[model samples]
Target: MAHIASLSQLQTPPWASVDGQLVPYDGVRIHISAEALTRALSVFEGVKGYWDPASETFSLRTPREHYERLLRSAKLFHIPVDFDYPEFLRRLEQLAAELLVRERDLWFRPTLYVTEGHWGEGTRATLVITAFTQQKESGEPMRLGVSTWRRGTDVDLPTRVKSSANYVVARLARIEARRLGYDDAILLNREGRVAEATGACVVALLDDEVVVPPSSEGALDSLTVRILERICHRDGLRLVRRPIDRTELLAAQEVAIAGTISELTLVSEIDGFTFPVDGVLARLRASYLQVMRGTEHLEGVEMVATDAGRALVTS
Candidate 1:
């Protein structure tokens, strides 16, 4: 979408929840000198709300887990969450109620921006919930390539925290991937171990075991990966996390990228190595599709479905 300088702001919903207060989207503002703008001091979470045709409701994937992770990011960056957790959730409930009236898919991102505080004065932050209508991907097969850009280590902008700054790596990696004639890039660590795909977690099926790189390898603490692990255990598949060398990914039986936005896209060809469409990723996608269609529900994650108004369908 082309972001027109002034008019682009008008395209989103009329209202936004800023620091627990629902305000006009046009009225939402942050100074040019703000820490989020100047120092890139902001952390956020991506939550997808899928519109289910059968139930005539919106199904969200792990909004609670996303929020909890956001809070942890805030804590790590010294950005105090200025809003109450329950109230924060209620704000989402309140926002979803009003916004989902159109009954289409949407993406809600709750970003915690460090509005103030440097030195010993104590940092403060603002929670802004922005909702926009987005089309859900049908999980396509992707051509993956390894990028020369290594994902940053824990000491240098850790990958574990879902921070705004992390997008630079993803953004650059994506551009480089496309430029290199591929759909996306797999970022390797300094040690040449597989970290993750550009913006999603990496899952490889090696010798019938679903293998994932550990967080120590600079992979994000992915909720989608957690769901995949549960699915593997439920289906009698072994899932393990360890450092994956660059060559190991080429040898994986099936490889895919997992995330909220990316969904679960299988990697068809990586570095010229082709993985014929197989049941490994297909099985995972089946469960994910079930979750989307609400045949299978998330445990502890509220699937917010709007009837005439807002209502919570908890797991």
Candidate 2:
């Protein structure tokens, strides 16, 4: 396992990419009156990169998928991306090289925001790509609780689009959970069906089957969950998608949360109900790590080291 440090412990890198240009991290800035700040007209993606010691390379898992999601989010928010997919990817790879990222696992936040002075629609869009060393927390299971706050429906805000404004609801629940000494909170839909955690998709093992809530139930269409589904199919593990209830989660044999940053985190307790770390969860977690590090290959998922990343690793 990579040594994970806390965000506070890791120092910020010297460089970041802004509008396709590499600049000093501190040099990158947005005006205080930017529309994205005032109206929260921003969409972003959190992508993970793993450092493989065996190959001396850094593998970025599914960059194209992340980029495609960002584009979808931009379309939903009316934020125009000036560059095409290939051009944007090339710039990101350049930024990663400029940052000199090598041996450590990394987290990249690629944000598209409205930068025009006006707060309403038809504003100029700006892209900022920032990469940071990933800090892995303890491998211990997380303690979660069901939040009183309900997730927004499609009519309220399209949950599938990862808009910055949409996260405020989850943030409130997270604050309440931390105040109560829980690791995080699982939110329910308006109809009292299990939605998801603040930033992750929830999964549970029930009767020897892996089950998750469908995206229609106010959950984000999670890439991590899709990857898990493929792993289950390959491994002969049963995977089911359906509406889950709070009581069902409480009665589950095991529960876990999957996300780009969180990866596969086991939920040790929920609403005082506890579960053991079983072998199935362990196998899935191990398989995920393998897939991420390029040791295990899956179709439709690419884990490649960028030229810039390779240069840094070699240097």
Candidate 3:
């Protein structure tokens, strides 16, 4: 399966929600002098709405969890969340309904950012919700390489907060890896311990147990990683959190990357070492997709509305 090489390949929807109001995607704009654009003073959440063909419904998996993380990020950055969780959820559902996304999975990006005024000190925060349909992943395993750049430590920056500014470091590493002929880059913390891939949490299979780097080790407290932990526990699989050394990752039986957008991507190679795609990882991915599609019962996932629920006009 060919990967989505760039954002240019994605077709943006005609409509988007700005501050809970539906507006034309082309018309939605932020000030050029906004702090979010100038200084990257923003935090956002990437959520997926899985379309269920059997039920003809679209279910947003663990939206509350994502919203909670977004709120935590806002608090960390001192960005004001003027609207509550319920209102945000309602607006997301409304945006999906307005888009009339009938049998395709959709992606939702809800961002909170600071605006112009006072040169980035105590400025008011703004919100925007953008929803669009995207092609599913090709299921091709990614080729990763160890990055020369180090992940930001807690002392340097809040590793747990999903700040837009934090991604610049990962972006540089990814660009370097692409230049060296790799799909993605794996970052190690200052202590030289395995941190994570760009915007994704990593788990390795070792000695028949699934092990992941702890949040203290510069790994983002990823919601998808937590979901995988729960699924592993329920299935009688051993899942543990421990500091993984760079050498340990190279010798692992298999490695998998989990995140909202990546969605349990299998790693075929890291640096020069390669590992086969394991069955446990495949099972976990299948289970996750089932839960996301509402075919399997899972907590924290809900179907807000369906295509048949109401009539909508996209234009």
Cα lDDT tens digits for candidate 1, 1-315: 111011224456887889878899889998887888888889998787777756666766677788789888877877777676667667776667667644567667788887777742567788888887654446568888999889889999888889989878877887898898888899998999999987789989898898999999999999888888877777788989988899989988998888876667788999999996667887788887677657886564456554423353321
**TM agreement with the true structure for every prediction:** 0.89, 0.93, 0.92
Among these predictions, the greatest lDDT belongs to 2
Candidate 1: clashing residue pairs, number: 0
lDDT of 2 by residue, 83-157 (tens): 887877776677767664556777788998789846455578889888877643436678988999999888898
> Which candidate, 1 or 3, would have the higher lDDT against the true structure?
3
Stretches off by above 4 angstroms in model 2 are 1-11, 117-121, 135-138
Q: Each model's C-alpha lDDT?
A: 0.78, 0.82, 0.81
TM-score of 3: 0.92
Candidate 3 ranges with C-alpha deviation above 4 Å: 1-9, 116-121, 136-138, 300-315
Candidate RMSDs in Å, in order, are 4.2, 2.5, 2.4
Ranking by lDDT: 2, 3, 1
